[model samples]
Target: MATQTPREAPAQAGRRLDLSAPWWSSPRWQEEKRRIRGELAALEARITPRRRLRAVIRTLARHGLLRLMQDRRAAAPSAGDASHGRHPHRDPDRRLRQIGRRLRLAFQELGPAFIKLGQVLVTRQELLPDPITAELAQLLDRVPPMPFPYLAVVLDEELPDGLQTFAWIDPEPIGSASLAQVYRAQLRDGRRCAVKVIRPLVDKLFQTDIANIARLARRLQRLLPPAVAASSDLPGLIRDYYSSVQSELDMRIEARNTREGRELVEEFGTLAVPEVYLATRRVLVTEYVDGWNIKDFPVDFFTFEERFERMIDLAHLYIKEFLNGRYHADPHGSNLIVWRHSKKVYVIDWGMVGRMDALHTEAIFRHLLHIRLNQAEDAAEVMLDVFEPTPYTDVGRLKDQLRSLYIRYVDTEQAGPHNWGHLLVEEIRIAMDNHCRIPTGLSLWAKGWSAAEGTARWLCPEISYHTVVESADVQILRRLLARRFNYRANAAWIAEASELVATLPRRLNKILERAAWNDFKLPVEGRLSEQATRNLNRMVNRATLGLISGSFFLGSALLAALGGGALDRIPGLAAVTTTALWGSLGVGVYTVWRVLRSNKA
Candidate 1:
C-alpha cells in the first residue's frame, strides 16, 4: 500500500536509502584525500621559491648599497691620490684617518646590522687585514635614536602602564646602538635607572639579514681557496655571529649575564656592576651609573698613583674572572667607567660574555704558570693540548714558534709594558697558520685583553700589562696554596699515601738485599761527618782483609785435594800449607779485632 504512494516514503524517514560507509573510510575516497593533501604540500613547497627570491632581492639590495658607498669613496680621491697619481707617497696616519672616516660613514648609512658587523669585525684582526680592522674600530653606537612615539609604544607593550611607570624619561637617549637604545629614567619609586629599549622590528630584520648572510657565506665558502676557506671558517664564523647577535637581541640574557658578572666580580670590592631592575626580551632596566666612561675621561683626571691603583684593580678583576672560568668578553673603554667619588670602576653592558669549562680554565692557568716560569716547552704543550691540531700541523715547528714568542714577549730581562693581549693574538694567528683550531672563546678572550690593555695604555702608557700578569700570577698562586692547605688532606692524598705504604716492604727488601751483596751505593754531597768517614774507612779495610783470607783458604784446600799430583812430592808442600793456614788465621783475627774496636768506639 505504501509502494502505491511513492511520495509517502516520508523522505526515507531518518535513515538514508543507501546505507554506505563514510567517504573518508572508503579506499578510493581515502586515496583521493591523500592526493589532495599531496597537492596542498606541493603548493606549500612552492612558497619557498618565493621566499628565496625575496631573500635574493634583499641581498642584492645590500650589495648595491655597499657598492654605491664604495663607488662614492672611489669618486672622491684623497689628497695623496690626487697629487701622486700612480704611486702616491701618502702619510700613513692621514691615509688611515681618511679610510676610517669613510668606513664609519658607510657603516652608519648601511644601518644597524652593518654597524654591528663592523663592531664585531674590529675584534677580529685574524679575519680582516689591519687597515680594515683599524678602520672598523671607529664604528660606534652613534645610531639615530628611535622616535619617542615608537619608544613609548614599546614601553607600553613591555610595561603594562607605559611611560606612566616612570616619573620622567628622557626623550633624548644617552646611548644608542644597533639593536637597542639606553635612556635615563626615574621610576615612580624615585629610583634612577637606565632604560634599554630594543628597537622595533630589529629582531625580524636581523633574522632576515643574518639568514641571507649565512647563505651567502656558504656559497662563498665553496668558491674560496681551500687555505683561505679553512683559515676563515666561514660557516663557524657565521654561526657565531648569528648566536651572538641573537643573544644581544634578548635583553633578558644580558640581564642575567650582568647579575652573574656582578656576583663573580663582587669580591674585588673596587669593581661593581649596575643592579638590574627589570629585564625582558627587548627591554632592560638597571641602576643609573653616573661616572666618566674610560673612553671620555682625560688622562690628567686621575693622578699617577690613582691610575696605577686603578690599573691594578682592573687587572685583578680580569685575571680573577679568567681564572674563575667566566670573563667579560668585551671590556672596551665604553663598557667601563670610573666613579670619581668612590674611585670604583663599574663594568657595564654584559651582553657578550665568555665561559670556559674547568678543563679549559685549568689549561689556561697552566699556560700562564709556564709563561711566568719561562718554560716555553711547557707553554707550547699546554697550547697544543688546548688547540685541535690538523693533519698538516708540524708540532715541532709550532713549538719552535711558541718558544720564539715566549723569548720575545715574556722572557725579557727588563720589565716593560709588554702587551700580553697582543701576544695572545699573535699566538692565535700562529696557531691558525699551523693549521691548529684555536677555540673561538680564546680568541674573544684575547680580544678583550687587547681592548683592556689599550684602554689602560691610553690612561697611563707606562702601565705594564706584563707586570700586572706577573703580580696576578703571584696572587693566584698564594690563594691556591692557601686553599690547598686550608682543608685537611683529601682522598687523593690518602690514596697516594696508601700506595706508598703498600710498596714500602718491597722497596725496603730490595735495598737490604743490595746492601748485603755490597752493591749498594750511597749518594753523598757537601761535608761528611767524622764518624761516617771513620766507618767508611774501617769497612773498606775489613772487606780487603776478608777477601785475602778467603783466597788463601781456597788455595790451601785445592793443594790438599791435589796431594796425589806432582806438588804432593815436593818437600815444601807441607810448609807451604802450614804458612797459608797461619797467615789466613792471622788475617782473620786482625779483621775481627778491627771490627770490635770500631764497635766499641
Candidate 2:
C-alpha cells in the first residue's frame, strides 16, 4: 500500500480522507487500555507468588510446624503400633510447655523480624495465651556484633569526609542488636561519643518479612475466635510495627526524637538525654554517657528517703511529659541509666515515641483528677471516654472493672502502697477484655510507666508509685489553679469593670424613678404555713416523678422505633430498652398510687 507524504497529504485531501476515529482515541479502546494498565499495576504491587511461597516455607520450617506435623503422623495409631494407645497429649500442661519452648527457639531462629514480633506479642497477654506470651516475653534482641570492617564501610558511605573527624574508633562493639551496633569512639576534638551504625540489608529484609507477616496476620485474624480478633487487632499491630521499624531504621529520626525528649525533660536537672553529634539515615553519633543501668544500680548508694524522693521526681517527670502530649514510648531499664557521681538518671534509645491529642490529654488529666478525688465512678467514666468502644463492648462491665481497679489501687483505706503502673496495665487489660480499643499513645505511655516504675521499685522496694502519683497530682493541681487564677486576675478584671461601668447608669436611673414614684419599701416575711408547704412538696414530687417517667418512656420508644438500625445491631440493646420500658411503667404506677394515698390521708 502507498501512503501519502505529509506535504502531499494536504493536496490529497481533495479525495476526502476517511472520517473514521483512530483506535487510540476510541472510547472503548481507552477503557480497555486503562483496565489493562490497572491490572498490571495491581499485579506488580502484590506479593509475588515465589516470594509468598518462600515466606510460607520459611515460617513453617522455623516454627517447627512441619516437624510437629511429622511427629503427629509418626505417632498416629496403626494396626501394628501398640504404643499409640497412650495419649501423650492428654497432659495439656506438658504439651503447652513444650510448645512454648519450641516457639521461643523458632522466634530466635527466624531472626529480627520474628524476634520483634515476639517482643510485641509479650505485651498482649490479654489477647494471647499465657504460656505463649510468657515465653515470648523472654525473647531478646541481643546478637553477635558485625565485623568492624563492615561497620567502617557503612560509616564511610554515610559520612565520607566526616569519618575522619573521629580520632579513635573502637573496633569492638559495646552492644549489638538486630538493627544496629554501638561502639565507643573519641572525636578529634577529644569528645567521647557512642557511634551507632545500622546493619546493611536490614531494611530490605524487614520490608519483605513485614509484608509476609502482615499477610499472615490477616489470615490469622480471619481464622481466630471473635474474642481473640477483637482483643488483638492484627492489622493495626502490623501497621504499628511498620511505623516503629521505619523510625528505628532512620537514625536521623531517632536523633530528632532524642533531641525533643531532651528538650521536654530538661527542666528536671536530675534527668539527662545524650547529645547528638552526627546523625544520618544509617549512622548516629551521640555523647557517650557513663552510668550504671537503673536495673543494676546499687540501692545502698542513696538513703531510703533520697531514693523515695528520686522515685517521686521521676514519676512527676513522666506525668509532665504525658500532660504535654509527648512521651517516650520505650523507657525500659536498659534504656535508663543512673549516673555514678552525679546520681542523675539518663534516658537513651529514643527510637520510638508517642504523642497525644489535646482531647486525650484533657481526658487523662480529668481521669487522674477524679482518681485523686476518690471518685472511682467518675474516673472510670473519664477513662471510657479516652478509649474507643467496639460494637461488642460491654460498657457496664468495663466501667465496673475500672471502678473496682481504682478503688483497689487508689483507695488508701482498702490497700497500701499500690503500684500505679500495674494498675494502669490492669486497666488496659480490662478494656481489652471488654472490647475497648485503647489509643496507641496511651498504651505506650502505660507500658513506659510500668517499666519506669519497675526500675524505681528495684532501686527502693519501699517506694510506692501510687503515693508518687498522688503527690504529683497535688503539685499539678496547684500549678493549674495558680495559672487559672493569674489569668482571671488579669483578663477578667477588665471585663468585669467594663460591665459594671455600663450597667451603673441604668441602675441609678431605675433607683431614682422608684424613689420618685414612692415605690421603694422594706418587706417583712412570715413563716410559711404547714399546709402550704405540704402542698408545695406534693406538687414537686408529682412533677419530678412525671419528668422521670416521661424521659424513660421517650427513650424506650426511640430505641424501639430505631431497632432496625443501630439499636438492633448492638448486642444488648433489646434488653436495655425492655428494662427502661418496665422501669418507667413501675415508676408511673407507684407515682399514681402515692398521690391517691396522699389524697385519702
Candidate 3:
C-alpha cells in the first residue's frame, strides 16, 4: 500500500460543528484530570501515608474543608504532641502575649505561603484565636537573601548588555518573600534605589499549588460539616488569595501597583509609594525611601500618647485612602515603612491592592459607625450587605443572633483603649458562625485596621483607638454625605463610569453569543415543579368551589319545585343559597381555566 504525503486531506464542504461545551465536561477536562492525577500519583510515591494524610488534610483545609475537624482534633486530648499541648504557665495576660509569638513561629515553619497566610490571618481579628491573632498581628515575613549568582543574572537581565550599566549592586537583600526578593542598590547615576527580582520558580510553584489548593477547597466545601462550612468562607478566601498572591508573582502587576498606590496617596504628601523603574520582566527597580522601621523607631522622642495618637492618625489616613478609593492592599507592618528623613509613611509592596466601589466605601464606614453605636441589628444588616449573603439565610434570625452576640461580648471597658481591631474580629467571627460569608475586601480591610490598631496601641498605649476611628467617621461622613447631596461633578468618577458602561455592551454581547451557541438552556427542572404545584393548588381550589356551587344550584331547583307544590319557609332560603352556589361555580371554573393556560405557556 502506498502512503500518501502526510499533509494531504480531503476538504469538507460544510462548516465545522462547534459544540461549545463546558470546560469541565469537555474532552479537555479529561486531559487536565489525567495530568493532575499523574502529578498526585508521583507525589504519592514520594511521601508516607502519615505525611500524605497530613498533606491531604492540609490541602483540604486550604480548600476550606476539614478545618472544623482539625479544630476539634486540636482541642482533643493529644496522644503525645507536646508542641501544641496546652501551656502550664498561667499568667493573667500571658496567653495573649504567647498567641502572637506562637503565630509568628507557625508562619516561620509554614514557609512563605503560611507566613503570608499568617499575615492575612492577623489582619482578621474577626476569624481566628485572639491571642494568636494578636501575635500574628506583629509577624513580618522579610524575604531571605537569594544567591549572588542568581542576583547577578537578574541584574544583567534588568540592565541588559552587561552588569557595567549599574554602579553598585548590593550583596545583601533588603527584603525577601516567597514570590520575589528585594535588594537595596545604587543606580549608575548614583541614585539610591531598590531592585526586586522574581523568585525563579515561584510563579510555576504558586500556579500548581493554587490549582491543587482550589481543587481541594472545592472538595472540602462539599464534604465538610455544615457548621465548618458555615463558619469559614474558604473558597472566597482562596479566591482572594489567588488575586493577591498571583499578582505578586507578576512584576509588571507590581509596577502598576506601585504607580496606582503612589498616585492614590500623592495628596497626603506625608506618605509615599516608591517610584517604579522601567525595566524587563522578573525584575523591578524603584527609588528606595530612606526610613527607620516604625516598630524600631525611638520611643522616647514623644510622649507615649502623642506617639500612639500620631500612629492612629496615620492609620486613619491610610484607611480613609483605601476605603474611599483604591487601596494599597498589603498595609502590614513590613510594607508600611516609616521614612526617617521626611518623617513620612512609605507603603511598599503594592502587589495586592483592591478598589472600592462607592457602595463599599459607604457600607464599610456605616458598619464602623454602627459598631460604635452598639446597633447590633443594624450592624448585622450592614454585615449582610457587606458580605453579600445569599438569600437562603434568614436575615431576621441573623440580625437577632448578631444582637445577642454583641450584647454578650461588646464590652466598652474590657475592649481596651485602642483595640477596635479585636472588636471587629469578634464581630466577624460571630457573623461567620451565624452563617454569614465574610467579604474578601471587608476581611482585608478589617485585617489592615486591626494591624494598624495593634501597632498604634503598641506605639501609643494611651491613645484611644475608638476615639481616633470615631473621629475618622465624623470627617468621612460629613464629607461623603455632603458630596452625595451636592453631587459634585467628579471627572474621574465620570470617566470610570463611562468606561464601565462602554465595557458592559461588549461583555453582554459575548455572554449572549455564548449562551445562544450553547442552546440557551436555562435550568428549568427546579422551577417546573414549583410552578406546577402553585397552578395545581389554585386549580383544585377553583374546582372544589365549582362543585359546591353546582350542588347548591341543584338543591335550590329542588327547593323551588317543593315550594311550587307547597309553600315552605326553608324553600326561599334554599333558592337563594342555590343561586349563590351556581354563581361561585361559574367563577371557579374560569379561574381554573386561566391558571391552566398560564402554566402551559
Error of 2 at 396 (Å): 2.4
Which residue pairs show collisions in model 2? none
- Alpha-carbon lDDT, every model: 0.71, 0.71, 0.61
TM-score of each: 0.64, 0.64, 0.61
State the lDDT of candidate 3 residue by residue for 218-296, as single tens digits: 9988886554576576777878887777677668888987887777776665567789865567788898988766676
Q: What's the C-alpha lDDT at position 387 in model 2?
A: 75
> What ranges in model 3 sit over 4 Å off?
1-74, 77-139, 226-233, 302-313, 374-377, 388-397, 404-418, 482-601
**Model 2 per-residue lDDT tens digits across residues 410-490:** 543212345566666677788887877777656666767777777666756664565667677776676556645777665
Q: Provide the lDDT at 143 for model 3.
A: 38
Candidate 1, residues 1-601, lDDT tens digits: the string is: 2121112222333321111223313454435445544654564454443474464456545545435455445545576464544543343444445555566666666456667877877777776556667767766556766554455456656875655567666666788887888878788788989999998666655666577677778999899755445555777877887788888989999999999988877677677899999887888999888889887776677788877777777888887777667788888888888877777789999988776665566676677678878888888898888877765567898889988887766543223445577677778888888877767677777787777777676656675666666777776776556545644546667889999999999999999999999999998645444467777877887899889997997787777677656466787878888789778878888887877876842
Cα-based lDDT at residue 451, candidate 1: 78
TM-score of 3: 0.61
The model with the greater lDDT, 1 or 3, is 1
